[model samples]
Target: MASFKKTATGWRADVFKKGIRRSKTFRAKREAVAWSNQIEYEIEQGHHDTGAAPPNATMYHILERYRDDVSPKKRGARWEVTRLNQMMRDPLLADVKLSDVGPRHFSAWRDKRLKEVSGSTVNREFNLLTHACKLAWREWQWLKEHPMAGVSRPPENKPRDRVITDAEIESYVETSGFSFKTPPATVLSRVGAMFLFASETAMRGGEICKMKKTDIDFNKRVVYIPETKTGVPRWVPLSTKAIKILNHVLDYTKGTPTVFCVTASQRDALSRKIMKKAGLEGINFHDTRRTALTRLSQKFGPMELAKISGHQDLKILQSVYYAPDPSDLVEKLE
Candidate 1:
């Protein structure tokens, strides 16, 4: 038999068979009735899988699950893993119940962290926590509710990300070509090739470093990014400039399987040196990713830009990569 009943908390439906019971909660009477009907039909179909969905799972466990099971499958696995490790170390989350965390905890954490970190950084933590709770609520049934439901992220904090502008790029080419650091005239070319290659490719620093002999296909004009943010492999086409750099690198490592090996810090130092030499102002290594998306979005829709960058959604791309909202109407009024 199927039955619907009202309780103080809300409404629920129960299905009974031989002293056994199955029930689900609802916020409305109509919903209760509909769910009751659905349960009865499911029973008739010989599928009864409802049980006491556990809600006492610790926050740490859910985060670990996401890191191990969910993150490694992403192209951003390296960065995601680092973020998860940092979250796991947070004192609030260390020995607490996932179910017990509420909006207060989330709000307090975000507010406090904002003082110490950039808003974009705070947003990353907030997003990470939200996803952890979502996995617990939806996939694991480990939480009665996701506490991050109403938690808002901090606004972006954009200090000039050090980027070598078009002017600087030309200066780098000029100085390296004629100056003392010029190419071996026997070995590969000198300076800016790696940086320019990276800028034009939009390939992440790590991706560029980890590239292999077999990854590039000159005729196809595509490089198979076998590992990506989604853990799903994807392909990114290379610009002619990017190809020229890769070919240059290949000449030096003719027998080696690894592409160019460069650390994030090393690249940063080189970029800073080049920026100083060219007398350019502001631009960061990661800004290349931004520059790529912004230019691409001009030609392709946000969706197409997202495809190249492996962003899960356009909103994220727009928030970070899109130019600031224009105010032409306000200007006209002024």
Candidate 2:
């Protein structure tokens, strides 16, 4: 027999038969009912494993299950799914059995990864795998112990202070074939407009890509972000320059619900292409946040800056996003 109940998080399904019990929670009632039905069917056919881990299960198997079952529930599901898929493609990690996986495998992977990417990238990947291992050990019963428990994380890297200058923004825009007179009809032109908008607004690339036309209130000069990286909703007050950029984008993307026609991946790819064409190096789309936040800091106090940047931690906002020129500070002091 199966029973279903609504919980604060979602729906919970419980199945019991022949002295065996299974339970799971899902974000939707349909998913819960489907899982319970599958469990009941397996039990009736005697195919269900009575609390025993599969003999041939591997690290890849655990991560695959996590990617499919857990990642979709997260706010950063797209990035998590992409990274999990990339990790599973590695034969060294994928082929190792769950019982055989230990600190040594991850340690080797960490060292090899450092040679290919930055310490920051390695640390993010480590955090993802660590969580996956923890869930597999505690909840899934796929491992006897946590595989990442013995592994050491890479050293934290210095936070990026790269601030995009006004001249560089112009160069990028010119190289991307966009001008004030031109319509933002092409992907490159739209991406350039997005870059300019980021510098004026300090919105993240993902947030900008997810924006809809209805989110903006021109009369109020505010944009409502329903979903943010921190999972908190915020209203970002707009500047005159930011409003001008929004109006330009609105003109081209008329009739579409989305404010920007480009996807996040397209924006990223086109950004790289335009930057290279402009002969710019070492600057990324995210640097616009630092630039805009730093510029905004001159006009607004720390508390106001935190609200605009969607940063919950003032320490992070000060340390990471607020990069000021020493010359400007000296002038202010004088």
Tens digits of per-residue lDDT for model 2 on 111-137?
Answer: 988998999999999999999999889
Superposed Cα RMSD, model 1: 14.5
* Residue 299 in model 2: lDDT: 96
Name the Cα RMSD for model 2: 7.3
Best by TM-score: 2
TM-score of 2: 0.85
lDDT of 1 at 284: 55
* Model 2: how far residue 226 lies from native, Å: 0.9
lDDT tens digits, residue span 247-289, model 1: 7666666676566555555655666676677666666556777
Model 2: residues >4 Å from true position, as ranges? Answer: 1-52
TM-score of each: 0.58, 0.85
- Model 2: which residue pairs collide? none
